[model samples]
Target: MSVRRLRNLLLVLIATVTLILYGCSDEDPTSTSSAGFAGLGQDVDGFQDAGSNSSLTFPADHSAHPDYRIEWWYLTANLEDESGEPLGLQWTLFRQALMAPSKRPEPTPWAADQLWMAHMALSQGEQHQVAERFGRSHSQAQLNTTQNSQAGVVANPFHAWLDDWQLKANDEADNRDFDNLTLTAYSGEGDTRFGYSLTLTAEGPLVLHGNGGFSQKAANGQGSMYYSQPFWQIEGDVTLNGETKTVSGRGWLDREWSSQLLDARQSGWDWFSIHLEDGHKLMAFRLRGGGDDTDQAQGADYRSGTWITPEGQATSLANSDITLTPQATSAVAGRDVPTRWRLEVPSAGLDMTIEAPHANRWMTTSVPYWEGEVVVTDHASGEPLGEGYLEMTGY
Candidate 1:
């Protein structure tokens, strides 16, 4: 690499690390008291907040929202190799504004107003390989053919990238911009290398959460604009430990953004996205605290979800409509993380036990969390129901 390019990359890394380690969350990464999990509930005095009336526009919405304090393009896949062994992977690009719109620094070649972080993980059996990258960019930076920013996103053709890791529209597809996409990301070298190059074709329409697209995260009405493309037919090659295998299965892509996504009293959350064998899909979450009822000691947990049909129809599940209970825990990274859960949606005639086949799916990044594939079964008969991914944070 040229000297100037190397220097620029170093500067971006330094800026991202400094912001995440010092300014973003609590001084103590482990503390959820002052700032909600990962500082998501921290003050948003100047940033734009997500509201019930906010409208979601396609193509445009697929790109970054610089006005929002935090946003991410997150995709998770559950696949099987040629031999049918289950494998799972996740690729997420997160963007956090360094300053509110009015407070942004002047746009310059070396100035950045956004800190970008991307995380990639591949897990199978007991093996879990993870990688993370950081970059910086100015929200107002112009796009040109000569050179692209270290990390950024574009709407028309739908491209989200950081360095060489990218998730973008598939030029060969005949479907809508986001309906057909391609993802490529790799890390490490030689024997340690792992990642995937996959094509994702949407089998169903995008499903929005909460009212329209306003997903309420707390009883105080704080929330984010959330939606998902949960029916993706994924096919491609996955490499692990330098060995490549043909894989094909389903994937889920989630889009959410907000300036203040949680209530100050909210600590962490347990989120699940499931695809049943019977053609139904479910998305549910439980925010540990931050609710209206103060009579309870630790405050009531805020719960919400979406019950999606095969045809793309959706039914919103309110707090009273869902139940998420931690059935079992495991020692992971010095913390007791819930690896088994009972998720019930009586309204949808669903009572299933979700358990992680592996408990070591910890992302040891700047801000760590537990994320991995899960098996779903009949709560009473133990009959196989389906498969999905589980993410537990602030444990």
Candidate 2:
């Protein structure tokens, strides 16, 4: 979301002011550049952009893309307990580097040019529990020596970690297909306690988004390498408010990396991952602002996604292929946020209205956002179609 822009802005702004008064120090390499939303839109120096010709390799792609300015390992789940009450869960690992790969600072003990942040949440009924943590590590040594640092990610067998929180391979198999994984995370204490211990197994193939995984975020060609595994069958245990219970459901995992994640004027994004009852999966997202003048004049936004069949075959979608209209809003975190939407993809024969049964999925972090489970239904008849997750950032 806006996590990268916020972190980069705050750090760079503070460092710039400090340098102006006390001069630049070795510990403070940050300058007051446009590292915020506007900075991200500008062409970056040193790092690599997501090129159309770039290809993705299996186990390596699942690990890390530190050469890029920002990357994340994100997961969201739609679950139900024994009584059939609905529940939602989310866990994300975000890594932002101060410098590109070639400019990595010397791996001196405690020296670093990278920052890591993690967010975890669980919601049901009117209850929502969330937690966030931040850490720092050297790009080179951080991955090698994981004793001190509280966060990191590895390739072989596939594992992403932050302190005790982890989403790792479950079995010892070395095929490296990345089909099975174990996700463990928790936060808070006493009556506010909440967490999950779940296992995820792929029921379909990995889905490459946009053109062979190069997901364009702007009409001007700025974008990221994006992909997803959206057919996960999950089963596990969860603790809510000091009570533990068995839970089973489905999940989706998204991996994306880029030097420029969005355009300068783009405010934010609305992303959706829907699991239909008929076994189909729909992944769609809209980037607000900064599209071409023609589309902008008509109030169009940068949109793209993939429609996945039960077997994982994916058809790439373009901005003209879909339409997302917010139909309702709710007061969350003191902001009126869209919690209901009408989604349609005419060529794909999809016309559905989706709404969040629980509208308070606000993640009050350093970069605040709203994300939770939602239900989809027929646009005309209002009949239930499926359930999935929704994420809205930057208001």
* Candidate number of the best lDDT: 1
Off by over 4 Å in 1: 1-33, 142-147, 294-298
Candidate 1: TM-score? 0.94
Q: Estimate each model's TM-score.
A: 0.94, 0.89
- The local distance difference test score of each candidate is 0.88, 0.81
Q: Model 1, residue 106: displacement in angstroms?
A: 2.5
Worst 10 residues of 2 by lDDT: 22-31
What would the per-residue lDDT of candidate 1 be over residues 87-169, giving only the tens digit for each residue? Answer: 99999999988788998988887788888899999999999999998888898852432228888888767788989999988
For each candidate, C-alpha RMSD in Å? 2.5, 6.3
Which residue window of length 10 is worst by lDDT in model 1? 22-31
The true-versus-predicted C-alpha distance at residue 238 of model 2, in Å, is 0.6
Those runs of model 2 whose alpha carbons end farther than 4 Å from true positions after fitting are: 1-42, 142-149, 172-177, 295-299
Give per-candidate clash totals.
Answer: 0, 1
